[model samples]
Target: MDHKKVMIFLLSSMLFISSSGSITAGESSEKIKAKLENIDYGDITLKDSAKVKPSFNLQEVSSNETKQNFYDERIPKVNLESGAVISQKNKQIEIPFTQPLDSTDEALYSHDLVIKQLGLANTPTLIPVMEYTTRVEGNQIIITFLVDYTDEYSVQVKDPYFIRSNGNLATPSDVYITTKNAPVNVDSPKVSLESGTVIPQINKEIEIPFTQPLDSTNEALYAHDLVIKQLGLTNTPTLIPMMDYTTRVEGNKIIVTFLVNYTDVFSVQVKDPHFIRSNGNLASPSEVYITTSNTPVTIESPKVSLESGTRITQSNKEIEIPFKQPLDSTDEALYAHDLVIKQLGLINTPTLIPMVEYTTRVEGNKIIVTFLVDYTDEYAVQVRDALFIRSNGIPAIQSEFYTTTKNDQLIVD
Candidate 1:
């Protein structure tokens, strides 16, 4: 009976030990399953036995999203000691400070902070800052300042400023006043034509227009001082008034017309050589024939011959004849007789007697007639006697020859 009781106690003790082992094994299995489900493969933990708790917040689950939000929030709140605010409201921001940050701020900073926040890489080196009282009106913001700083600052800032650091701020530029002195003692302007330059005859009237208008108050400014220089000419400049000029503008070009008064300085010279001839004495009619070496000439009623060879008549009526022949005594006598008869008709015939003598000679390609006549009737009568001969063998007598006698009238050949 004792042996039976010992068996029952041993069996009960073995059953209890078996149940405790199963319970411990089941608890370990549950803990292992929970750790396996919660463990982050991305994170490295030094303690293998340590348990990892599951994060309940949806945002905490995404490491990338958490980092992005942190950066976005941190960038906008950045402020500089220079009173510059780096915020999302101002699309453009400029920073001027250049210094290392102290340990008081534990935030992570980067040079690309503005770039990353704004999603813009190429920002202006220096950006102007404007601050004024702003009022919200509907969808727009109306900003006003009692004493605006931007205008004053712009006057002071001559060149663009370069940004040196992030979150740095600068005061607005200062106001400046610049004064310049007016030009002094400006002489009147002048227009000059180039030397040896020939302008079109039709374009004698020219008007020159200025790129910029002259002062209306100063009349001298409107006056044009012009100088014209030509080849083989004196260097005297001509002056004219600009107000009298006319102008027209075609695109960017100016057409100027000047009322120019031009004068020719050189005088033309004319010359000719001529000869006067008679039969014997200067009292008789003479003939004149002109020879010109240069320009052509016109004679006004040029009396080639005259009964009184002492004088020649040149009047309003003119006659033109080219120089071709050598004038001599015979030609002179014939010309004089013909002129008297033709002009005064046969009724006005004054017994014509040659009073001049001409000695004709030929020199090279030219013919010359020398005058040798004096105003004397005796010399004319002597010439007439020498030229005339008795008709039909009758002895020629001066008185009977010229007078009408008996039944015979005086005749001359």
Candidate 2:
């Protein structure tokens, strides 16, 4: 055999034996100890000599490995109702959760897997607390949750929403009234005159001024009638004659006037002015007089009689009597006496009584006549003439008288 071939074979055999021994040694306690020494349990303060209990049991270790797989399978199966899938291929799918992933272990693993596959955090994740149920129907997911997390989180991020509608805010229009111009000041006196008096008829047109500028078209602003309200006078609402005026504008004022009638003076009594006496006598004229300061005033009788008769005295005034004759009576003489008293303006009418007795005797061709009167009362009697003689031959007359009663009730001749 050649020495070079022998050297190659021996080197190959040695290399094979060394490799087998290394494999067996790697599976031994020495390798296990080395691995355990290099691991840090995090914040364990035990000294090198201290006896530390192993936190990991072989059974638990095995179960933990199984639980890791269990968590991965169960978490995805949770359906994360409030989330959606961004990408998927074959049996694997990438879902975009509504919120950040929360589980510590799962989040780390999912992050690594997602970064490796998607090359970014684009595989959206959610907190374990946010996982909910969703029903997939066609391209849409009917998501439902025990708690609504979207709205709860949005309140912290955005403003509230509102709606707009018609007739929300409005304003109204304005209305007003206007008037015309008229004369402000004018003086007019109301006068009453007697009938049959001739008066001056002035037809001159006067212009009345108004206080404020007025629209003449507005009749309400114009004077419909001359309203003369008597302030100091006792009577009210005196009606004055209506006069039309021509309107003229001088600066800002108006002036108005009317032509009044004038008449001549005449004298007449305003009242009956006289009275009648009870016994057909007249009172003194001074008792029935009246005078006025105004001239051209008409005086008319009241057309009625007072209790006294008319009697004019030296005082230049008519006086009243106690009685007057009745105007309406069935007695002709009484009515005639009344007419006479009225014509004379006497206060009363005289009362007439019948002549009671007449005495006649013939004495030597001469006739002597005696007259007597009877009054109802003794005080009413008055003897004027007792006797009168008529001579037949010469047509001569004679008279004589004698009184007997205290009231002169008897007469003799």
Candidate 3:
């Protein structure tokens, strides 16, 4: 029988045996039931009575679900004893402790550990940690680096701040790292040019973005050492003098600005750039070849070759032209054949002059146009091609300045 039923039967038997009445068993049974119902079982204390406790198999049943959970699985309920233990600096370093963790896969990459920095670069320098790592054998953290900046680094743990052990962070100051001299790898210092390095125009600044700073203090020295060559097919190598350029290092880029104006293919490179890292490491001399875009030449307007350069009091059949830059004297002949002198008729229709004779000459920055015949009525002139070449060998943009003028009246149309 069950415990409850057995107890009730034994109690009833004792009651029947103790009865001093000359009564039947069936009558005694009914009286026992009524007496048992009247008994106050709620007043009993089972824990207090040793005798009752041994007789019944009484145990408490509960449904108090799960006890506790972790906020971050990587952070275990570590024992607070001492700080961490870092070993050495190499491609990898291990921070170990004493205890079993609930997981072997550490959820560490998320923190950087606040690990004081991040991300990789191809040396020229600051050797950053590998972008992410997740290897941790219970109680020990293994960090793999992108670059072994130092051969031997003493590992340790103290703290004002970071490194995730004790379920807290140990900052760079927390973990003592002694870095030694980096091995001299010829390919150690690396760099790349930002896109669109080719300059489209002249007399503007071009920035050379570098991985590390160049010797910032030597502006004049860099300008002297660096060379800029204006490249062309047929002429000897024309060098843009250092006096016509300016160099400076601003925001990790060497900004070489042009002071003089010209348009052609040009190359810039450092002779001995003296690229220096913040830690005082020097990068070897290297060649950086970049080309500036070669664009067409250009000019200012043209007017009558008079004292006023106007046709107010018609004097001679000549035109004076001003150009953007000095003309290459050799290409002066190239400009002559391309000139189209015409007459704007009374109806504003242009009539081309079939036999026009003119001689072109470069007078300083001006081109004086002396027409051989005096055929002035309402003359207009226009270029037919990019013929006027600059001293730097770049031609002027085509068919510019369609100038018009008339005889006698105040006209330089």
Candidate 4:
């Protein structure tokens, strides 16, 4: 063999030994020899021998992950004081723990811890808590959000799997906080009646406006006090009573319809704080007095006669007269005195009819008349000359009325 060949073989052997030695040294550097305690919310202090690695990256970790999935597993859960958490944009939040967190390894727990403000019913608010850095500081972890705080808050940890240096995983849990400093009347509900609406008309509507939108599903409208009374009458204070009136909400206004019996000078009283707003707030109480006159509504009185194109015949003893409009049947007194038979045509000589028994009724838009009289020839009947009032209290003009006659056999021989 040649000297050059021997030298080349020696160089190759040395290179192999150096490469193998370096590979063995790399393994020792990567091996961990440090110990760690439980991971908690706090600052971290790294030691030369720290070995526990976090499951996620701290820089890219978000505090929002713990909002919905946080669970506490302790036998007796720990919580912050009631209403102790105040919302602040740049303020530091100090969360104290029962025990100290392991700072020997910063990577044992995730940095995705977050603080959130709890709303009504312990639900989270919509405002986002800005990203924050975590460190094991004594027995507490300090947090800071990017936005100002408007409510109480709680703490949550994402990737709560707390791994210790001994390869043991800690139970996952969350911390809740409350605040005592809050606005006294941040969400109070308010309402007011429409202006220039002190007097509501009979069967007319009035509206009440609210400062905020009301709860559409709330049944507060059903709980109301409706009373009506004449200003100077000696009658008892009457409750308009349920079912007499109606109330409903349209948008932010409450519509109230009055169902009154009379137009006498009366006062309508409604109790205040009668409803609840959508924000779980109560509606303030209010009273409104409605003043109206004793004026009665009037309608036209109908003329009495046979139906149009109808004629009185021997077999047609019934007289049906239609009115110009639909009559208000609610007025019983008007129907009783509005009609009277004055004259009866007997033997074709129109003679005064006295002491005649008759029956009067209403059907649809017409008043029906019937009488017991003997007819021996073509005849006619006349209504009395008087002003008859309609069912709605409107008086009909004084006019003479005559029934139509058709030459035929007598209605009753």
Candidate 4 lDDT tens digits, 1-413: 34333333433333222222221112221131111111131333334113423233233324555532332221111234432333333555655554455555433333435455443334453332334444556545555554555544556544544423233333334554433233323354555545323443444554556676655543334335335554322332554444555666777766666566554334455454423443434455556444434334332344543443344443445566566655444432234344554444444454433325445566766656555664534434444432232333333334345454544543432
lDDT by residue (280-303, candidate 3, tens digit) is 233334464445444442223232
lDDT (tens digit, per residue) of candidate 2 on 373-399:
332221111212111111110111111
Q: In angstroms, give how far residue 212 of model 1 lies from its true place.
A: 16
C-alpha local distance difference test of each model: 0.25, 0.23, 0.46, 0.43
TM-score-best of 3 and 4: 3
The order of the candidates by lDDT, greatest first, is 3, 4, 1, 2
For residue 398, model 3's alpha carbon misses the true position, in angstroms, by: 13
Cα-lDDT of candidate 4: 0.43
Query: Of the candidates numbered 3 and 4, which has the greater lDDT value?
Result: 3
Candidate that scores best on lDDT: 3
Candidate 1 — which residues are off by over 4 angstroms? Answer: 1-199, 206-233, 241-246, 251-253, 264-413
lDDT for residue 115 in candidate 1, whole number 0-100: 21
- Kindly give the stretch of ten consecutive residues in candidate 2 with the minimal lDDT sum: 151-160
